[model samples]
Target: MDCCTPSAGRPSTPVAAPPPGSGDHRIEQVSVPAQTFAMGDAHGDGAPGDGEQPVHDVRVPAFTIDATSVTVADFRSFVTATGYRTDAEQYGWSAVFHLALTDPDQVIGQMQGTPWWLGVEGADWAHPGGPSDVAADDHPAVHVSWNDAQAYCAWAGRRLPSEAEWECAARAGLPSRRYPWGDELPAAGHALNIWQGSFPAVNTAADGFVTTAPVRTFQPNGYGLWQPVGNVWEWVADWFSPAYYAAAPVEDPQGPPDGTARVIRGGSYLCHDSYCNRYRNAARSSNTPDSSTGNTGFRTASRKS
Candidate 1:
């Protein structure tokens, strides 16, 4: 099933932001130097249909990427300044994890294949679980689409990282490593935010969170990028293509020339080894430009101008 699906109902009213802190409005960026790195699942451990095969080399130019995924406070600031409405707000609803909802009636529908995802009315970035839920300011902003991320990037004078750049930065200069830290998965609550225990049905929250954790909840990678593998699936600036990696350029590939959906990299708090092992460095996925979900978010990137 698709990670994000559409919902039916009205959007929730935007929530007021808490008092701004020094870090709230600032977008922290880490400089990723120009370098060539292998950019796909050469190890063949990723899901079969995930299109992570044919590991290839890619060179990315120097760029600055956000240290963390955009936070709720950051998105809130943008909305407050621009009065921008997300696709979710425009569509009136977005997909929310069933575990996040308190009231069963709030679920408008369930995704056919991924029944764990509930189409929740009044579920937007502000109300992650529907009208009654409020996202913590420090949490990574969820229920954001690629379109929403692009808008935020425009407002912030940045852009989404290209898929190549994203993978390079995620690798953190490590070559052929399963994760940012190394080959071995760190003990829960050590380096990243991801599902523990049974996925879809039971989340042990062994990482100290059942859902989205604070943006800086984990240690930064070698490039100083925070939560590069987990927390939320980040939208990248590339159209999806299963075979694109084979023909992808060695120097600064930008994904397919055109396609229906955009690339989404890394994984999210919902990922687990049993079903969704997408949190690996070379793993990838995609979704429609306008799709939003409680487990998706994005960070910004920019040329070192």
Candidate 2:
């Protein structure tokens, strides 16, 4: 509910990633060198409860991460070979943005605060909005839970990047800039696929999309990472804790040992300045690991060899 999806259930157990080498799940990756950097609201202006304050020093080791998020085609290959079922498919429903829905009958219920989200039956990565709304092959695979992403990584011989690694990668050599490109978005600019006009009501589609865009729609960051700041809220391999940074380890800080919800980074297409303005390098959100939504997806990473 924080960033993208409503909580489906409190799943206490973590799903094991499937065995490696079940499919040809390869992706183009870019390397990020080891470095120390400030890992918080560089401008000291972030949401209150979301906790992007007290800019802290953090260091990460060399690692390689996917240049783009895991697309529908990539997930399809994994499912085709492993016959794996996503959490959404297992639960028989997933959260969908109201504007993305084609059939109202597919909606079973809606969240309390965020009425824009509808719990639709038969909604999964394959059928994002509803049974009729087929996902594009190149679009980021939405409706995928954190567990689902981990399973994909298992089959692909990859893993989700830690929150530290994710933020570090998204920074892409622009330390203090809110966006990977620069400090501020140009007037009437289309840097990323985010809500253009008034959120949830009058979207001008000025950014070429009211929903998810294809990977690399905008220019790559300095490290050649694609769409690092916007498009979808990506799942990272870290538990959520607003106070984690206060006492976190400096070098290669993996998040807290345990948490009810996992951290999500890079606000999604639904993000806007009028409402959910979390589309920045340091901005963060979290949801239940089992929760899935239309605007949430993930990329994979590998430790440097």
All models: lDDT?
0.81, 0.85
**Mind giving the per-residue lDDT tens digits that candidate 1 earns over 12-124?**
33322222222133877799998888888867887767678788888888999999999999999988877888888877778888889865777778876778888777889
> What's the TM for model 2?
0.96
Q: Return the number of clashes found in candidate 2.
A: 0
Question: Candidate 2 regions off by >4 Å?
Answer: 9-13, 16-22
Clashing residue pairs for model 2? none
Worst 10 residues of 2 by lDDT: 3-12
- Angstrom error at residue 257, model 2: 0.3
Clashing pairs in 1: none
Q: Write the per-residue lDDT of candidate 2 for residues 199-229, one digit (tens) a residue.
A: 6777788989888999979888888888877
